[model samples]
Target: MNKGVVKMDFSEEKILETALKVVKSNIAGAKVCKPVLASFAGRKGQKALTIEIRLDSVKLKYRVEIKAAVTKSDKMLLAMTNKETGLPVMLMTQYVNPEMAEELKQIGLEFIDSAGNMFINQPPVFVFIKGNKLKEPVRCAIKRAFKKAGLKLIFALLTTPGLENTTYREIAVAAGVSLGSIDYIMAELKEMGYLRRRVDNSLYLEQKDDLVRRWVMAYPEQLRPKLTLGTFRGPEKWWLHGRLPSQDTMWSGEVAAHKMTDYLHPETVTIYCRPQKLNGLLLSNRLSRDPVGNIEILEKFWNNDEKSASGELVHPLLVYADLIASGDPRNAEAAEKIYEQHILQLVR
Candidate 1:
């Protein structure tokens, strides 16, 4: 393969075209056919393209999903989509690195990429290719609704019922963001098909699970870093007796998971509090700032009243995000419990 940039539009048609070129060139007696748009009932925003692959005389059809980027969270959803449709679902993306490629193959899901990296396990067409690199990565415009302040606003809408239908000022207050950002964020949500206008002209939020997944993936990168107050070292079992003024502080990460699910023993503690209260919290808990500390405090981004009924703990969504972001297997397991018991209804 030539290491040259291929400037192309990032559309379903273009993605399929680029990937199939590699498929035909690499596999013997492979034939490409036009793809058809595939839509499923009860799944509004999940769309795929049905592509046909001919190996000699045998033809295999796949529900080809097109994605700009794929992550671990996508694995379960892709598997469920395959089961629901009873057709082999193949993922077509810009690239699938070695780690994700192995995980996807382990789950028996097929995938292909424009870089010529692929895995196909259907009988009579066992093709596995890896280590091919793209000359340059494709870039796309990111929507505002997934960025920092926009994420806060979207979080408010996702967790609060009828918040999207409320005034922009109220949405801003709840999200602790500027009122001016609301209109553009709402517009971007509508453009992305996550929000729709009803016949009465009120906004309706749809495809919430997908939205939640995107929010979780972007938070650690886009918003969480900007909110960090500091990391500190505290006495062992400090959280066991520590007091948080419920009005100004809340728990997250491992501590929040243990408090909410009573599952894993917390190895670290996470707190979210107003900026002005950081010193008060540390002084009260006898914590000292440390670069590599067991305790982390982030500036609280959402409003005080937005706290869920759990009181001292942030919403289950934030806890789940914290665990997933931690990249620990135990935390990931605990996050599953939080998702099932507390956060499932919010998205569905």
Candidate 2:
């Protein structure tokens, strides 16, 4: 072990207790310190360690950093901490072999070579359960199994190219749920409108009914028109006809849509948002001049587009923003009606 490096089995409680002792020993007269353990991580292939600590007292609250050498076996301790403290723990490294680097890059893991090139890791898509209604053990077990098996399954199904329709059996197997219990949970989700059975007898988990699906599935189609327009000069010509949004935007939208769908539970209702408009000059000159105003303008633009539509528009971007701005989108029916009317126009 390197100097200043501590070798220990990873246990959240043990690490936390050791951290508190270190704090107390280091900070003389720190009687009033309240140490809240945040998270921890063990770097792969290296003994590097990092721990987040929040210290609170009457004077002020401050963060404490503890760094050390760590190994793979330490990850279990960190994961245990994450389970108990509800903080995220990430296992990462900057020194990966070229082949491993390529593989990690493909899976979207944050990585860097010895040469200092950096890559950000992609987070796993999470299926959230709402209302504190789910059994914690079951959810945790499912999440764990999903994290462990999800990438393998993704590769097995070759689902990288399109939306993969997964079954309860798949989810059950991936999530470590019992076959018998799958039906009960599926039934609950069905009743809550978070999932539906397809004609193929497979289960489709919806973020919220048909709205998220339409937006996600239709986004590329909607962009086809703007993408076909190619490069243009002004706002007037800025639309994605056939081209896709930048990778960042598409990924962000996917994540946002998934989150909204999980939370909103919209059945028979759909949420919609127009594709973000990107014109080089407009974005660089006018929008960049004032970011706050730029966002405001974008909001106004989205609102105006929705308002001008002859039918309903249910994009959560439009509805959620308006809900925050004016408290109207809170009414499920009203929001759904708006979405339906606009969607109807698009289809017609």
Candidate 3:
């Protein structure tokens, strides 16, 4: 059972040939014509090719765009193809999974795969044929864009809710990642349809809840433990009343939720402090490291300006995610309250 990319080095001639065969065979009475290589204006400094074919039987021509696969990110390419050729846009590829046809249609492009599964939306003739797939199709791309650096930039956007339109350089500086990394993350978000760019080039989230849920789900599974510097046995008083690192320390988890909602009587105090002040806070509070400690010390993930200026609590979004991720019904209820008050009131 050998499985690999069937057409990694696919060429335009091969694609054009395959598409010609698929269309020729699919239409019973359609006469196949020659494939004409056509070029059109694309992104700046880039020209794109469209294979034009004349159908003698139907007396209509088709402008076929060739691609390896049509993933969600192909919206831009589809737009360019449509813009370049006012003729009906049909996509022919080496492979197309039946699942991706819907996403292609949403962007106003029709497709026919090498495997014979197809959806062509040209009018006066809407054709849909299924069940001739030769092999499992490949997904567009794989990336872990929500890891440390990406998470930092996203947290700034989601928590602040005002930096959505900020420049890439600003995001790179704040996220502490390279400009290249920011570009990658931005593409991933745009492809996922979670992030949207306005006409003014300002970016914002279309599904804010979806973004939060993804972060929260990944946080407990991945980011949370990395952030947990070391748990320690301590009283909640240090977070509430004692003299801790005032500027660098912030409370999260249950205590932070309670601060914003006042609906839950929290049993544990979740605290976050800058790394430079972590040892001092631990020494001053007489805290000892314990694997199952009541106090969780999280490494500060944001800068001073990113933290809340009016309260000791962390951002409302962080509080909500922490509580909701706890998997406790009571915590989930408190999370809703925090969402309504602090999260809604503060973040857009």
Candidate 4:
């Protein structure tokens, strides 16, 4: 084999250990100077990789600063973030093709990808980890398994896992898609190793967390936009902490997220109204039709009959999905709580 697949088969700590061992095996006396996280006070972000190595190699009583990148673009971004920190670099990615690997070599930077592709060039230490070059290209679009409607099916499946034993037509209606779409979705999910078929009509979620992560990443890009009818402003009084307009509406997005977690104070309100009841909402709430408005109106995606324990709330799963999609740090934190309290409870 020209290159080996770097199994993303390890936990975070194990991945770190594997990376460190790979480095140690390559260098004569490579020892870590210290572990440090690279953060700039001026920059307003927490994603800065907490670089463990104060330096890369301490060999023969000498020291060299070593910085690290855990993702593909991470290397590029860290090249800037680590500038003031004064450290040399290492880049880790999911996979690095041989052509790209060679470019890293020419640039004189040390790197390792999850695929086991690595390169290091410090004085008295020259190493290269050339993994299986990608034989085929990767598609830019999401797999058919994660298209707009498929997300809804996945959401419904997780929220109400019993759907695993139900009919495909039932899943189709619940997901707001057609029967053919469900077939393609189920097949693709099986091939991806996230689902398994039972002797009966049942289909099961195999890798629940991984599947949810994939769905969360796609929902904002593929599903949410399609569900959104428009963004508009509503009367502020309607969004008080425990009160919402009561006409066939369900609370969602940041408003719902805040209520669940108490971790964030929300400035936006997102709600779903049944298509048949949209006119009544517009008239009753006097909601304006603004493209940039905070109040978003979505036609319900799942079973309209599905009600929250409280009639005015959307399912916590939807609330979690919306918070994660916001890509805001505070909202993202709140999303985790919704996932833990609501989604996990449902699965259990």
Whose lDDT is greatest here? 1
Give candidate 3 regions above 4 Å deviation. 1-142, 236-238, 345-348
C-alpha RMSD values across all candidates: 6.1, 19.5, 13.7, 11.3
lDDT of 1 at 4: 16
Give every collision pair in model 4: 3-131, 3-132, 35-52, 55-65, 55-66, 56-66, 118-129
List the candidate numbers ranked by lDDT, top first.
Answer: 1, 3, 4, 2
Clashing pairs in 1: none
What lDDT score goes with residue 29 in model 4?
Answer: 59
Could you tell me the lDDT of residue 247 within candidate 1? 71
For this target, which candidate reaches the highest TM-score against the unseen true structure?
Answer: 1
* Deviating ranges (above 4 Å) for candidate 1: 1-17, 29-91, 98-110, 122-125
Give me candidate 2's TM-score against the actual structure: 0.22
lDDT of 1 by residue, 1-348 (tens): 111111123464567778888788988889889876555442333444578899987888887766667755456556545655546888888889988898888878899998999999888779888888877556655567878989999888987889888888888999999989999998877766688877899877776766786788778767988998999999999998898865779999999889887898999899999989988898888999999998999988987255557688888888888887775656666877887787777876
Worst 10 residues of 2 by lDDT: 133-142
lDDT of 4 by residue, 131-236 (tens): 6443322223446766777887887777775676678888887767778888888877777666776677566766565466557656776777887778887777
lDDT of 2 by residue, 247-268 (tens): 2122112222223343343211
Model 3 Cα lDDT, one tens digit per residue, 1-348: 011101122354566566677777887665655654343332221212344433443455555556554433243334433654456567777676655666566666677777776776655666787657756443433245557767777777776555757788877776556778888887777766667767887776755643554565455544666787887887655556645657678788888776666678877768878888998888888788999877778887776256555567778777766775565546756765666666554433
What TM-score, to 2 decimals, does candidate 4 have? Answer: 0.61
Order of the predicted models by TM-score, top scorer first = 1, 4, 3, 2
- Which of candidates 2 and 4 is the stronger one according to lDDT? 4
Higher-lDDT candidate among 1 and 2?
1
